[model samples]
Target: MQLFTGLALGSVFVLLAVGLSLIFGLLTVVNFAHGAFYMLGAYAGVFFIGYLGNFWLTLAVVPFAVGAVGLGVERWLVRPLYGRGIDYPLMLTFGLAYILVEVVRILFGAEGMPFDAPDALMGAVNIGVGYFPAYRLFVIAATAVLVIAIWLFLEKTSYGLVIRAGARDSEIVRVLGIDISQVWLLVFGLGTAVAGLAGVLSAPMRSVFPDMGTTVLVEAFVVTVVGGMGSLAGAVVAGLLVGIVVSMTSLFAPAMAEVSMFALMALVLLVRPQGLFGKKGLMG
Candidate 1:
């Protein structure tokens, strides 16, 4: 049962960390606003769920909505900082995160909002070993499907080829007459869209609040780092590993559950430094 829960938690991390990896791999921007976009997704889910009264529609619409916002953000804010060193965009996003949190507080109040799981997924089922929430199973299965879709999009499509090539050498791609700028915008939007999807999926499992993104952002960063910066496969592997470690540790020593992940990260860094699948020269 705990293992199942861990897998569910890992699914959320995979969703969040993959986006972070994608954005960093191509855009070269460590978007601190990712968590804020996640929060926006949750709040959007709340609004849409009430307005549309359909969880499925909310799930489909929220990602594109937040992704569109990401497009605007990339164009208006982050794009200007290109060629200005990574520090500028990093600092800008850090501030943008705070501003977004404050804006949410103003609109939704500081209180935590309750978001119940959809009626269809409200119960638990026996998975041979023990009972687990149906929604969690859905989370795991849904994440797997989304990850596969993303992989196919990147591996089998022309746009994906451009993105892969751009991540390797933007100058060379641009020299080939490709519009690297548009690709960057699309990558940013896609990354944030994934984050938004994660946020919506997580809403029913936790309280929806302005500061909700803070802790998850840290965890996602840890997943990104532990999996190797800018490595999509690394994010998927590390997210699941971290999720299981955190979950299992909680079963024995609750006080150390959070610390266990950091310890694992420290160990990995001390050994590989570049992470499990990361290449040399990838990390600063």
Candidate 2:
């Protein structure tokens, strides 16, 4: 049961870490506001459930809505700072995160609210070892599908080819007459959209609140780094690893649950600084 729980938790981390890794890998920008986008997804879920009243519909629509917001941010806020050094965009996103959190707090209030899972997903199911929440299994399956879709898109599609080429060398892509700008915008939007998806999925698992993204943001970063910076495969592997470690720790030592992943991260770094799947000389 604990292992299953860890896989579900790790699925969420994988979503966040992949988005973070994609943005940093391609755009060379550290998006501190990724967490804010995630929080928005949860809040959006709250509003959508009240209005639409359909979990599936909300899941489909929230990413586009949040991704649209991300598009606007990229075009208006982050675009102009592209060549001003990495610090400029990083600082901007850091402040943007604070602003987004405050905006949500002002509108939603500081108190946490319950987000119930759909009635169809409320029960437990037997999966060999024990009965586990049906919703958690759904999370695992959903993440797997999405991850596979992502891999296919990146590996087989023309747009994916362009994005991969851009990641390798944007200047060369531009020299080939491709509008790397549009690619960057798309990447940013896609990254934030994935973050929002994770947030919506997470809403039912815990209380929805303004500050909820903060902790997960930190954990996702650890997953990203421990998996090795800018490595999508690394993020996936490390996310599941960290999730299982944290969940198993909670089973035996509840007090150490939160910090266990961090300790794992430190150990991974000590032994393999490039992470499980990271390439050497990635960021110096």
lDDT of 2 by residue, 1-284 (tens): 89999999999999999999989888988999999999999999889888999999999999998999999999999999998888999999999999999999899899998899999999999999989999989989988888888889888999999999998998999999999999999999999999999999988886799999899889989999899888889989998999999999999999999999989999999999888878777764
> Model 1: number of clashes?
0
Model 2 clash pairs are none
Identify the runs in model 1 with alpha carbons over 4 angstroms from their true place.
Answer: none
Local lDDT at 260 for model 1: 93
Residues 151-205 of candidate 1: C-alpha lDDT, one tens digit per residue: 9999999999999999889999999999999999999999999999999999999
The worst-scoring run of ten residues by lDDT in candidate 1 lies at 275-284
Please, what's the RMSD in Å of model 1? 0.9
Candidate 2 global lDDT: 0.91
